[model samples]
Target: MRADARKNHDHLLAVAGTAIAEQGVDVSLRDVARRADVGLATLLRHFPTREALLDALLRTRFDELTARAGELETSSPSEDALVSWLRDCVACAHEYRGVTALMAAALEDAESALHASCVAMRAAGARLLTRAQAAGTARTDIDGTDLFALVAALAWLSDQTSLAPRADHLFDVVAGAILTSAGNSATGTTAPRPRP
Candidate 1:
């Protein structure tokens, strides 16, 4: 890409990021172009599609979260690494409204623009979960898919106006359920109660 085109692409992405943060993943392409002071054609030239645009915007974040998992894996205890990565993943998913659904869908759709990034992110968390489980800190029943679902669920909860306040507490509740007594003690979480 030429310098000027690259500049425009970066500007459009920056504007799109703010728009998506304020509005959501569903924010209109025209609105993003308008906000960026660019024509729709120019935006399309750079991104081609909304998914492409989002793929570009979110790929970096996904990579960072993946790298963070690797870092935590080496630096933190197994349980701590898993829990910390879960928290970070949830927070990242919550950053852009409506992204959780897209991520969930993308994870299953190999052709989706976001598929690779989402898979890598899930794998990163899965590695952390596996490490913790191997150490007998996390539950043996749940797999990486369950952890990914929990993240989507937590992000969805945060998206709800009515349930937003309870998201954090619920995150702990879910996290506790994923962790065993030893995991709970390490993370300062209590075991979840059995349902009646």
Candidate 2:
């Protein structure tokens, strides 16, 4: 891509990220174009479809979360790393309203633009979960898919006006359920401490 075109693409993605953060993943393409001070055609040239645009905007965040999981895997205790990564995943999903549904759908749809990124992010969390389970800190009954579902569920709870206040409390409850007594002791609590 030429320098000018790359600039436009970056600008459009930046604008789109803000728009999606303020409004939702369902925000209109025209609105994003208008916000970026670009023609719809220009935006389309960079991102052929809404999914493409979203893929570009969210892929970076997904990659970051994946990398973060890897870092935590070696630096933190197995249970701490899993809980921290779980919290971060939920927070990322909740950052852009309505993204949780898209992520969940994309995870199952191989053809979806976001599928690869979502899969990578899920795998990162799964590794953390596996490590915890191996350490006897997490439940063996659940798998990576279950952890992914819990993230979506926790994020969905934050999106609900009535349940938003209880989301944190519910997260603790779910975390406690996932951890064994030994895992709970490792974290110094049944509900692991919040990430700093």
User: Superposing all C-alpha atoms, what RMSD in Å does each candidate have to the true structure?
Assistant: 2.4, 4.1
- Candidate 2 — what's its lDDT? 0.90
lDDT accuracy of residue 93 in candidate 1: 84
lDDT of 1 by residue, 45-77 (tens): 999999999999999889999999999999998
lDDT of each: 0.89, 0.90
The most accurate candidate by TM-score is 1
Off by over 4 Å in 1: 192-196
TM-scores for all candidates: the values are 0.93, 0.91
Q: What is candidate 2's lDDT per residue for 19-104, written digit by digit as tens? A: 99889999999999999998999889899999999999899999999999999999999999999999999999999889999998
* Top model number, lDDT: 2
The alpha-carbon lDDT assigned to residue 143 of candidate 1 equals 88
